[model samples]
Every structure is written in C-alpha cells, then in structure tokens.
Target: MQSSISLPRPIPRTALAQAVLLLLYGASAHAQTPPTAETMLTPVTIRSGAEQENAITPVTGFVAKRALSATKTDTPLLETPQAISVVTRDQMEAQGVQTLRQATAYTAGAVSNYFDSRVDSFSARGGTVTQYQDGLLRIYGTYNTSRPDPYTLERVEFLRGPTSVLYGQGSVGGVLNLTSKRPQADTLREVQVQVGNNARKQIAADLTGALDQEGQWLYRLVAVGRDSGSQLDHVDDDRLVLMPSLTWKPNAATSLTLQALHQKDKSGSLIGFFPWQGTQLPSQYGQIPRNTFISEPGWDAYDTTNNSWGYLFSHQFNSDWTVRQNLRRTVSEVDYRTIYTSFTANAATGRPARPVFNSDNRTVYRDASWQINGGRMLLVDTQIEGKLHTSSGTEHTVLAGLDVQRNQTSQSSWRSVTAAFDVYNPVYGNFRPPTASQLMRQPNVEQRQWGLYAQDQIKWERWTATLGLRHDSAQTDTEGRPAAAIDDKAWSKRAGVTYQMDGGWAPYVGYSESFQPLGGVDVYGTPYKPQRGQQWEAGVKWQPPGQGISAYAALYQLREKNRKTTDPSNPLNSLQLGEVKVNGFEAEMQASLASRWDMTLAYALTDAKISRSNAGDQGQSVASVPKHTASAWLSHRFASEGRGGWVVGAGLRYTGSQWSGTSAISTPSATLADAMAAYDAGDWRVAFNVINLTDKVHITQCLARGDCFYGQARTYTLTSTYRF
Candidate 1:
C-alpha cells in the first residue's frame, strides 16, 4: 500500500489560473429574472416536435409517463427503457441545484457527496444508489437514512437499473424518482427572492388555480425558505418548505390526486474539501463558510430537523382499466456536533493546527405502493393484434399488471459522546447545556425493513419488449428479538429492441436485472442472496420532442457479479465475494434554437471497477467513482428587443477524477465550473450564481472508519422573482 503521491514538475497551474479567475468571476454574474420560487419552472420546451410517448413501464415495466410532465421536456425523457436521467425543472434551474446534494450531481451516472458532516451518498452504474419518491424506496447511507430535500421536488427521475421488480431491496446502482408536484391547468403565480454570500437569505412560493367554475377542481400551493451563512467557516443553514396539491376530473373516465409536504431544516456539516495541504486558491477556505456550518464541534453546535407527510391515489377505469395508489408518512430528524482545526504540514513541525472530529444522527423512513392494470386482454399481444400477425405483420401490444410495494423502514440511532454513555464536555461555549451526567444512555438501536414486489410490460411494433418477473420478500428486524428475516425470492428480466426513426433515430438493444437486500444481520442468523445485476445497452434517440428540439445517445455495459462487500473485521459480517464492473458512455443535446435559443448538453464516460475483492483480485478503482462527467446549458432570448423585457440563462459544468476508497483511494477533482444569469421585466426577476467555476480542489467523503470528508470549495448565489 504505497504511493506517497509525487508530482510537482511545473505543477504551478495555480489551480488552473484560479479556475480561470473563478470562471471569470462566475462568468460575470449578470442578473434579472422572475424566478424566485414557485418551484421555479417555465423554461422547458427544449424539444417540440416528434410526439408519441409512453413508458412508465416499457423501459423496464412500470415507470411509464414522465418527462417531468412536459410543457415540453416534462415527463417523456425519450420514452424510457432503462438508463434514464432527468433532473429537470429546467435542469434544476440551470444548475442552481439546491439539495439532495445538489440534485445528485447532474446525473448521467450519479455520484453525490457529504459523507463527512454525517453522510449523504450516491453511486451509479457501479453500485450504491437509493432514494425513490414516486415509486417508493429510500435509503441514505453511512449508517443509513436522511437525504431527502430537493425541496419536495417535482422532477428527479434517474432509474438506471436493478430495481427488485418495482423496487423491493436496492443497489444495482440505480433508482431515484422523486416527481410529486402535480395539480395543474395553468393560471399560476410565483415568487422568489435571493441574497447571496452568507446572510444568503432566500424565499420561495407558488400558487396554482382552477378550483371550480366548472374546471373540475385543480389547485396547488408551495413555499420555501432558506437562511444561509456559510462559505465554510463554521457552517450555517436553515430551510423550510410547505407544499399542497389537488387535482380532480369529474368526467372522462375519472381522476383524482392529492399531495402534502412540510419540512424544516437547520443545516451545517456537508463541508469538507481539504487537500492542498495548507492554503491557496480563494486562499484555503471552508471553516464552515460556504454559508456557515460546523454544527456540534468545538463549542458544540448542530441543529437539524425534518418533518414529512404524504398521500396519493389515482384511478382510471376506462382506458382499458387502470389503478394506482400511494401512501407516505415520514418523520425525519438530525442533530450534529463537530469540532474543527486543520492546517497540518508537520514535516518536522513546519505548520500546525489539528483537532477535527464529529458526529450526530437521526432518521425515520416509511413506504407503501399499490397498482393494478389490464389492457385490451388476449395476453402477449394477441387480441387480433395486427389482425393475428404471421411472420410478416407486426402488432403485438400486450400489457398485464399487478404490483405491490410495501416499505416499513424504522431506524433510530445516536452516537455522540458515547464512552458507555453519560459523557459531557460542553460548558466552554455552552454546547447547549449538557451536564445531566454527561448524558449517557443506551437502547435506541433499532433497524427494521419489510417488502413485496411484482411487475410486467410489453409492446410490439418497432420491436418494443419487456419481460419482468418479481418476487422480493424481506424482513430485517433488529431490536424486536428476531434480529433478521429474509423471505428471499427473485426473477428479474428485460429484453429490448427499438428502431423507429427517420429524422429522429431510435436505436435500442437491452438486457436488465437487479435486487439486493439485508438491512442488517449476518452473524450467522443466515439469509442473504439477492445481488444480481446485469445490463448491456445500446442507444440512439434524437427527438423533436413534440417536434421542435431534442437529443440522446447512450452506450453501456454494467455488470455486477455476486457483489456484497462488508466483512471488514465484521461490520455486521456480510459477505458475497464482490465484483463490480461498469462500462459507460452517454451523450445528449437539447435545443430550442432559432426562436430564442434554449440549450442543454450532457456527457459521461464511466469505467468503474473493483473486479474482485474481499482479499482476492483487489483490482481497485471505485472510491468517489468517476472516469469523466460533463454538463452544459446555454440560453438566449432578446425577443422584441424591448417592451415587457427578457433575457436569462448560462451554464457549464464538469466532474472528473474520483475514487477515494473501495481500496483505490484515488482522490481526484478539479475540472469544475458553474455560472448563471437572469432577468425578465414585466413580472420582475433577477439572478446571479457562481460555484467552483474554478474553485477546484474537490472531494466527497465517506468514512465511518477513522473518518474523512471534503467538498464544496467555491460557491455563490443571488436570486429574485415575483409574478402574480
């Protein structure tokens, strides 16, 4: 284990000219806009030609209608079929991406951060990824749970692969839906106001209409809040959000929807990004000052809070029969503690400053789902499909369904100042008055899980196909005496072919499989087998998105063999002779062009590996997991040149160099960039944004063993909006 890292020959790029002078001072933060909050939208319509969409399940078998829900680009991301990614709300408002760790780092093969400051993780294609909203499933890690807050979201997607038949147990390196925000007909009002550079205050709002007067009921309401103070110098954050929704159609085969969300957050921790040794670039930042955080450390500080509510039911009993149901109840909690000091270059006492440690945790998760479907019956497309085809006709469109997903995630944990409990040392800065016997106690270690799954999807005519089989059973009880339960069952499959193009090419080929579980328990109570992942995909799908602008390109090979790692001196002792393989390629191009120029460009090339480990062929490479990632967005609109006023948008992003663990420990990050500008007059708006445009030096941590973390070295924000 040696490679003291040596390289400095002409290595004075000065963090690449201070990241091109902080991306030219954030590409010169120009501003204006009417986008302050109301779930900020209105910039979608990138593609407007080539209509015909269907797939909530055709891509895999039950993820059907979604493109964010198109006003264009809403809910139709190239007609699903696996290997998906849609972070839209107009690309998270041109990448001002707030939370869910900045919207899973612009997808493509997701990779998140915040492992130190108490966990928030992600991994895609190669393994480790969870958080599904509309389709259930949620598990955030580092002792699992707590990573939800993309502002109650309305678009998140990202269903790559291995979803135990509609999500039972996870990690084939995929899954993260989040949608939820329906209720619309038009007529809305929005408000957003922002101020950046610590004291970075923010406000958000939304209002929808059409309640009666015959419109058959439709309403919506949303709110958001953020009180910031960090650029990392002892971190600080505060957030609050509320959501309301309702939709009902009195005729046309029946319809109804309902929604609710309430959240509170006090954040800090999520700042780590050190490794330049002593200082330079923006002159060595992060002391809890990317806005402010340190939450419980040195003087004791950390206060995080969460609250959740959910309910949904959908019905359609006429378009060949349909039924959908959802229920959610969540109670989230987090409290942190941290102490800081870092600046060590002790090569014989040349520099000094050390003392950094922290911890604080809390979580509660719940899940449920039910669906039933029937289509023109006759099975496998033979109700005179294509008039009873013969080796020549083509008309097979059959779909049958029965799905059930039930999730009960119960977890409780707190490990701070625990030397057998009753340990207090908070009188210095009054760490919130701790001295009731140093507050020591035990008996809050509980982790439980429950699951059940089923699926099916098929269509023929341009060769659309899928054969999904599911039977996932789980029960992991730790604290209820039975410590572990596994009703193991599996059968997952997918086969594909798509070729129906002429001005918008549609080329496809596929194979898919996934499911993994074992919440906890393996001290010999036995029961662990559900780690199967397979995928070989080929792609080409360019759209006119309803007909106007569009793009897509994909080439992939993701394979996971008997993968299950974590027996490192018995951390619950689970083993499965690991093996991870990820070969990736993706390219996309979005356009509005000509009529006011709208843009989007995405790219990724991953080569994740750990080919074999568990003390065998340790073929490393899989820490922060990154081979290369690219992102883009450009906007222009000068319209009538005057009058009401208009102009908004600009963005560029890049991520490269990863792997700080999985045995490789190959830390790499510095090809980062970001910028934004906005203005619109009439309803009023203003904007400004800049992030790591070249603040370089990046790293996302994940270490529960002797701890480690670093990320977010540069940042900026400014916003404004009002429309009523």
Candidate 2:
C-alpha cells in the first residue's frame, strides 16, 4: 500500500474569468449561434415491464415487473436484490439519445461521464449518480440543464447494485430511474426526423389522444429541438424541450396521473480540453479556434432551466381491495457558463485560442413524494395454504404498504471569472479574456431529505414473500449552519420461490438489502458513515406467464462496512476498517422466438475489491467502476400481415479498465459498436444510426501539469417519422 499520484485542481485563469462574468446574466444577447440541422421530437423513457429493457428478467435488483407486452416484462432485478440495466422505448428510438449521458450508453455496469457541465453528474457501481425523476430525489448543482430528449421516455432503469432502500443518500455506484410519459388509452401518433454527422439535425413529435368521445380523459404532448457540432474546438450543442402529460380514469378502480416538464440547454464548452501530454502535440494540441471564442465570440457556453409538476393515484376498493397514491414536484434553474482550458502544462498543437476555467453557476431544486399502497386478503386457487399448517386444503393471500419522501437541493452562487494563461503559463497559446484579478467564489449548497416506509406481501404455497422497513431522516444546511445530518434506519428484504417447471421451465430464488448516506467527506472533521449495502441472490424465473419466451440466471454478492481515511497525520480523522466486496454473474434472454426473432442477450461479471483498503490504496479499483461488463441486442422483423414492416438492429458494448485517479492516474476504457435501420408503414417511419461504430479513440488521464484529457469523436444520424 503505497500512495503517491494525485492531481486535478488546476482550473484557474483568475478563476476562469470570474466564472464567465457570473453566467453572463441571462445569456442570448444574440451572437454565438451555431448548431441545428433539425430537431423536434422529444421522448424520454423511464418505466416499463413485459420485458424489453434488454430482456432477461427473473428478479435481480429492486423489483418492478409486469408483462403481457411492455415488449414482454422481465423487470425483476429482484426488488433491490442488486444488478439492473433497463433502457427501452424501443431502445430510445433505436439510439439517438442526447442525455442522461446518452441514455445509459448500452448499460452493463452503466458507467457514465456526461460530457462536461461538471461531468453532467453521473457515477454508478462505485457510486455518485444521485438523480431521480418521477419519484424525485435530486442533487446536481447549477444542476446543468434538465436534458430531456429521448422522445419523452417511458423506460430508463439501471439499478444494477446498491440502493439505500427507496433511496437514502445513495450511490455505492447505482440507481437511475427516468420513467416519464403517460396518457395512453388509444389514439396515438409518433413522428420523427433526423440527419447525421457533426452537423446532425432532428425533429420529433408524440401525440396520444382522448379528450371527448367518451374516453374519460387522456392526453400526452411532447416537443424537442436540437442542434449539434462536435469534434471539439470551441465545441457546440443547442437544445430545447417541452413535455405535457395527463391521465384519468373513473371506473375499474379509480386512477389519475398528471405530469408537466420544460427544459432548455444551449451549450458549448462544458470543459473541453485536449492534450494528454499533447499526445506529443497532435490530438489537436490546446486546440480552441473554430473561430476563437471561449466566452466572448458570444462566449462558448451552456445553460439550463427546468420546471416540473406531478401526481399519480390509483384505487381499487373491492375485489380484494387496492390503493396507491403518488405525488411529485420538481423545480430547476441553472445559468451555467464555461470557458474551457483546464491547464495543459503550457501547450502547442493545432492551437490558437485559450482562456481557461470559468463559471457563473447557479442550481436550485425541490422534490416531493408521498406513496401508499393498501392491503387485501383473497383466497381460492388450487387450494392449500397456511400460517402454520395446511394439508387437506386451503388458500391465502395478503399484502400491505406505506411510503413517503421529501427531497431537495438548494444552491446559490455569486461567481466571477478572470484568466490569462495558467497551465504553467510560459506564453500559452493566444490567451486573453480578463487581464486582471477577481478570484471570487460563492460555493453554497443545501440538501434536505425525509423518508418513511413500510411494506409486506405474503402468499401461501408455491411461496412468494416480501418484507421491507425504511426510516431515514436527513438534514443538511451548509452556508447557514448545520453542516451535515442523517439518522437512517433501513431494512429491505424479499424471498421468492417459484416452481412449475413442466417443460415451459420456471425457477426462482432471492434475498436483498441496500442503503446509502454519505456525500463525500473524509478530510477528517468526520462525515462519512452510512453506506450499508448487502446482497446474496439466486436465480431462475421463466415462463409463469413468461409465455411466448423467457429466461434467467443469477449469482451475486455485495457487502459493505469498512471505511476510513483523512488521518494523514491529523488533517482531521477517519476509521472503520474491515469489509467491502462485490461478486457477480448474470444472464438473460427475452421472447419472440419463432414469432419474429426479436432478441436481447445479456452478460455481467464483476469482482470489485478493497477487501480491506485498510492499507490505504491497497489494490485500488472501484472508482468510476468497471471490472467486466457486457451487453448485446439483436432485432429483426419482417411481418407480412399487411405487407408493411421491416426492421433490423444490432448492438454491442464492453467496458473493463477502471482507475481514473487514486494514484492509478486515469484509464477510461472503450468498446462500442451500434447500428439501427428501420422502415415501417402505418403512417411513415425511417431510421439510420451508427454511433462510435468504429471511430474509437478515448483517453481521460488527469495528472494536471503532466496532462491528459481526450474523449468524444464519432457520430452519425439519419431519421424521419410521420403519423398524421
């Protein structure tokens, strides 16, 4: 255990020109425009079942399954057992995603790096991706933009390992749920349009109708716009999104749903830097000329603004009874500004423009939630159940529940900027943006969380069980007193056993636990204790109604309790010492066998470690996370029921090369290949996408003076949709 190798705190050009003049007021004074070929459609997925988040569901992560045609329903990452990856809405429109870090990029271990804007905030498996949409749990200062553009999604669940039980200050590296898009009862129309390359363009529209005509009430509206230009050099990307939703039913067990959203992102320079030691001076050394303008020529920048409102209610008073209620509220405001150049040890290569690190940031957020699911008791089915004895005949069924949440993220910033060369400045590129002094800052942060939960489900015989308990109280008010707070008590457990294998194959096994409450702190002063993740699972859940096709495989282990650092001779203090491990194995497959050849193949192999970092850097690994990951998808359809349907799809992604710091000094692995082609005629549709299909070239080393930073290259798109 030897520790020596750290660097990443060199962003100062007078503090990036007073953080770009404090975010340039309200931007768009006109000037600084470029990015748009076409964009309109707006779809962003986040909740689905009936198998299609890459198929293979047999209970492995946090339980949420129901299939009959959500493509087919395999969503049983097992009610929080651990390990989850689901991103479907026909695969985010056959791949054209523009955020949430590109819609979970092929999910596997779900590693994300959201191109700047402060890494667009994402970290999973090894932790730190604290974001929630429908159920609202927020954190992301200046929050950087709402980023809604997967066409208004309805699926995006990647719960692959560790969730503090309904969320309690999380991220042992896992949790992402975007699910938004509701109002369906009939009348639907989907439209699309796209053009590719760095000059890509897009347009999309979604319409789900029912207002009169005796259809109670149902409506859905989505809108989006985008413009792009990338390959670096001043960078570029522009966006706008708006979403509206409504759902209501008065019979068959009351129901109600309402949602609203609005987002805008006009960007450029979310930290764009090159020269991993100047790749000897070629990867475009210190480049930034595409018309030289890091924050002036309209100032290469980024902006974000968000607004949200929500509600979901359901009731089934009879027929064994049923009750559920949900509510939500989200508000966001981010006026982010940036001016590249995070130091490149001087510089020289394809260059001619420099300013360096600046920000006029602002982030504000509020989230609310309330949940309740009542109980019921029913019987009669094969007859033979009990609570201590049953053999001659019997039957039983029972269920119970309760839940609550109130989340928030309040941020305040009074930023400033100034820079004139600081990569060890020796004459660095043309540099000039604020030849003065103004190193100012106003890094303010606030967080508040509240959680209370209770649940139980028990069914006799063929055995099905569930038991959960959560009690968390969180409070944080830095910048105004009360630095940190958390009083958490969590326990989530589930046991499953299903057997009816008579050729259609059916097998199952399960158990689970996960919890979180640590927001980075170990420089002593103590504030890092509240990460209890535990897991042990077994698998097999095939065709119960898995009908048309189904499959599953599982084996897992994730344990925790042992952490301590920041005693470097007493800068503060920390100690927990003893225990941390991750073991894994997973497999999958989803129906349509001899019916159309639709498919989803899966694979996962992990062995993260720190067995005992007590020795400190002892065996590192598990930051940014990746031991082994995999995903595969194959699609096919050529129906002739009406002579108008043809589609083809392909996918692959593999990541295995961790270490971004901690003395290991960066190593951002890569393995990407994607393809999509479609042509359907009900109204009209077309597609063609080939991201990173072979333009691979990645690097993310960070040692500062020594340098290292390169990523983003390879893109293509072409689309069209019409439904009138």
Best candidate, lDDT: 1
lDDT of each: 0.51, 0.50
Per-residue lDDT tens digits of candidate 1, residues 407-513? 23233322232111101212123234344354333223222223333333333555554444555444333334554545556666656656656675667776777
In candidate 2, residue 634 scores what lDDT?
Answer: 71
Q: Residue-wise lDDT of candidate 2 within 1-724, one digit each (tens)?
A: 1111121123222222322332231122113332232311111122234343323222222223432111111223332223455565655665656566767765555556445543345654454566665444533443434556567866666654555544545645556766676776667777677778768576767888778775657888888777876655445676667788887654334446677777776655544343233322332234322222233334335566666665555444444434444445555555444544433223343322331222211110111111111111110001011122246342323333223333334432323323443232223234233311332333334444444444343435444344445555554444443444444445544344444445544455545556665554555445666666666666664544544444466677767664554344654555656456777776665444433455556666666666665446655555545666676767666775432487777777776666554552555566777777777786887777776687765553343243345544567787878887
lDDT of 1: 0.51
Kindly report which residue stretches of model 2 are placed more than 4 angstroms away from their true locations once superposed: 1-83, 86-95, 98-157, 160-235, 238-266, 269-297, 300-437, 440-500, 503-509, 515-528, 531-540, 543-636, 639-645, 648-677, 680-724
- At residue 542, candidate 1 shows an lDDT of 68
lDDT of 1 at 553: 75
Q: Which numbered prediction scores highest in TM-score against the true structure? A: 1
* Prediction 2 global C-alpha lDDT: 0.50
TM-score of each: 0.30, 0.29
